[model samples]
Target: MSLVNAANRFLPSDTPAAFVADAQRVAVRGERVITLSMRHAGARQVALRYELVGAADAPVVFVAGGISAHRHLAANADFPEKGWVDDLVGEGRALDPANRRLLSFDFLGADGKLDAPIDTADQADAIAVLLDLLGIEQLHGFVGYSYGALVGLQFAIRHAARLHRLVAVSGAHRAHPYAAAWRALQRRAVALGQLQCAEDHGLALARQFAMLSYRTPEEFGERFDAAPEVVNGRVRVAAEDYLDAAGAQYVSRTPVDAYLRLSESIDLHRVVPSAVAVPTVVVAVEGDRLVPLADLVSLVEGLGPRGSLRVLRSPYGHDAFLKETDRIDAILATALRTTGETA
Candidate 1:
């Protein structure tokens, strides 16, 4: 059988039901996941779905989240609590799925939606696949955080005229040593059978490690400094609670294999500066370890006149894009307005 046939066969017989259940689950949490059927420019007919955050026809802005699978980005998915992107979609936020079509999809993965191969170029092509399906010949803008940022860059490079503006948050044009190192270990962990999928224990631990670098030491120190005072043999501190929440949630929802594949792919990212000429904004978090401030600068500088870099103050590191949703929203709302004019 051909890949497409195999893919269709691999899909659960109850995919329609499963898809509806997933969407409803997100809806209960004030989010929605809409599945879009589209085919790649080639013969590969893909079942693509994106998490919707805003209204339709207001302006289409594609939000790129997980590189592994679309389900991974679901608010109710078995991952750490959904963050900024979720916060932004409510009522009046920038990319409100209720007001504008906010689409976030996953790239092709290695196995049954649980694994993603680092096909950055193909991943970009997949966006075209989605656009074709949505009957959207062009997008008003594109916004991405971290790995999604790289995917957005790829899209802009390959489909420059397709997007009006691009916003890359907490992402780097090139991989840093810290990111590469973690990714290597993650890949090794999966290869050695230490982790089976993105939500596996080993992969969870690996993610926990990566999560540490995504934030700032000072933030942890300040947040945990007071520690939890012993009370009836029970103690709690905001910092400990925060870390536990993030770590526990991620391990529970995300599959180990999917995490490893996506993380590894994110680690190997390298952007062709010249490939991007769209009016772009590279937002760098001050304390981000995964994506250094320098890297954001490089991306902006590389974009020349068409690119501008903005640094935001956040103790949350790379995850700040989610943690600091309100702040990020303000920036995005402003960017969308400005980006249109500039683009």
Candidate 2:
């Protein structure tokens, strides 16, 4: 199914912006309208636009996730609907806006259509510029998942002193063969001669495949054991409902081009040891199909003693970062506390 196909099925009359509206509401309170604007990309010489949220003078955290322009979690409404950050920003979460400044933005890259060449390092540097705009001299931490994790690694390497700690979940400093292969297909899907073809069927199938890898067999089986009874000729199992809901949700909030840019950059990551001096923590999932455990292990080993690693036993694959929040919270709280004292 293509993004268009899925969108037609669930939201034939609504736009992706509608989902963004609802999610933005969940993230902010009264009078906080979703803000979008263009920022000068110092390194790339192009004025890259990004969507931004939160306020200043608070401890800051910068986020980048796979090829998304700051709304990947909300894009998939079924698994996460709102996003992992939503929990943190809520009244009682660690990132309560009352105390910390949370920054999430789209990286400079290929055009919104995902047809251009976007460098991961450049995107990281662009974010650094965004920090300068916000007058943040240093960050409490740089956090990421999947592609965002790759961006976080790049940030840690390029501006180590500027970041206190790096939290990478289901991400690696380097791209593995499996990730490369999967990314290639996604790219091919979006690169079809006709743009509509890529965005509709190609990217749709790509998302479906990516979703499969993001979850484990046990998780999928448990949730989808019973086939969806054909009601009105549509069989909607819990698992299928979950995926479609996620897909339909994102089709509106995220553009196909953004996904291409981020996914490609993630596929081409390489670490520069001399550039990475900050403390780092790499969070691995037991069943990440895109990035295997060995890849994360290598990242931890290469980061040395100050760099630590922990793995979560989740059958949800890479989606564990959202599905299994308790463990995520515990690990993050401990890591942040440890960094506050040590870094």
lDDT (tens digit, per residue) of candidate 1 on 1-343: 2222223332332223234333422321112122322222233434453343333345778877544334223243322344335575555677555445566654555333533345455667777766664557788888888877888898899899899999999777778887788668755655555634443555545655666777788777876687467767887655656666666666655555556656767866677876796889889998787788988888888899988888888888877877788888888887887334421
Give the per-residue lDDT of model 2 (tens digit) for 79-183. Answer: 233443554444445544444555665455433543455666776776776556545678887778787888788888887779999888888877888778977
Candidate 1 overall lDDT versus native: 0.63
lDDT of candidate 2 at residue 20, scale 0 to 100 = 31
List TM-scores for all candidates, in order: 0.74, 0.74
Model 2 stretches astray by more than 4 angstroms: 1-56, 69-84, 110-114, 192-198, 227-246, 273-275, 338-343
